[model samples]
Target chain A: DVKVTQSSRYLVKRTGEKVFLECVQDMDHENMFWYRQDPGLGLRLIYFSYDVKMKEKGDIPEGYSVSREKKERFSLILESASTNQTSMYLCASSLRQGNQPQHFGDGTRLSIL
Target chain B: SQQGEEDPQALSIQEGENATMNCSYKTSINNLQWYRQNSGRGLVHLILIRSNEREKHSGRLRVTLDTSKKSSSLLITASRAADTASYFCAPYALYNFNKFYFGSGTKLNVKP
Candidate 1:
């Protein structure tokens, strides 16, 4: 079975603080993604990495960025956390090619106050 | 800006009943996938149907896709209380290699 592990399950941060969320996959997948889920908005892609040191912006990538220094690890960074940035963040990974199914981590619920 | 949308945002049914959820996408897709999320946790991939395949089944779940209409439907037979969750449809486009458009999801409640 594929395992995707997130570093934080629940996180609380203050406004204007820098936050980092980490994810690691054991499947040796080449694709990694970050998404923020909100009610009525579903899951919106924030950023994705196709390979080590390669990143791409999704539909809503203005407030967030990503890092993929290694194949097994992916990180999401918030430049300066805001109250509006509070959301449930999810990390996913899949094979490099084809329309493969993505495996997801448990998710981290971030609260900004 | 989601590419797919689910119909009947919420549904309620009794145990042993059959539940169906429909999803519609805006553009052409390489494949359509269904996912299940319990409460507010991460999503679990339930099924995946390519554009060329019309229908597929696994266990008690059945999925049907219609490329001409750009729609798909998921049916769970003999639903159990444990089947209660939010179902989302994601249409993977050919243009993007590592991205998918996920639907808002359909929340289902099963009463014993």
Candidate 2:
């Protein structure tokens, strides 16, 4: 079985604070992704990394960035947390191609006040 | 932009009934996958169907894809209360490496 783990399950931050969400996968998958889930918007991709030090912006990358210093770990960073940034953040990992199913970690529910 | 859209945003059914959900994609895809998420939890992969394949099944779940129509359907037979969750369909385009666009998802509520 594949295991994807997130650093935090729930977090609360004040406005203008910096937030970091960490994710790790045991499967050594080559691709990792970060997404934010909203009520009507579904899962909108924030950022994705295909390999170490390689990152790409997804549809809604604004106010968010990602890091992939190693194959097993991916981190999402919020430059300045805002109330609008509060959301359920999910991390996923897949093989080289998108055709393969992605394994997800238990999401982190972030609340900004 | 969202590449996939699921029909009937919400569904309510009783236990032992069969539930069906539909998904349509805007562009050509390498594959389509179904995932389920309980409230406030992470998503769990349910099934995957390639563009060339038409039908696939796992347990009581059946999935069918029609490339020409750019549509797919998922049927869950004898649904139980445990099947209550939000179901999403994601389509992967060949041009994007390891990136999948997800649908709004169908909320399934099964009553015992």
Number of backbone collisions per candidate: 0, 0
For model 2, residues A83-103, the per-residue Cα lDDT tens digits are 999999999999986688999
Q: Write the per-residue lDDT of candidate 2 for residues B22-81, one digit (tens) a residue.
A: 999888888899999998898999999988899999999999999999999999999999
- Candidate 1 C-alpha lDDT tens digits along A1-113: 99999999999999999999999999999999998999999999999999999999998998788889999999999999999999999999999875999999999999999
Q: Looking at candidate 2, what is the lDDT of residue B69?
A: 95
C-alpha RMSD by candidate, in order: 1.0, 1.0
Report the Cα lDDT for residue A60, model 1. 93
Error of 1 at A108 (Å): 0.2
- Cα RMSD, model 2: 1.0
Chain B TM-scores, listed for every candidate in order, come to: 0.96, 0.96
Deviating ranges (above 4 Å) for candidate 2? none
Candidate 1 lDDT, B8-40, residue by residue in tens: 899999999999999998888889899999986
Question: What is the Å distance of residue A15 in model 1 from its true position?
Answer: 0.3
Compared with the true structure, the alpha-carbon lDDT of candidate 1 equals: 0.93
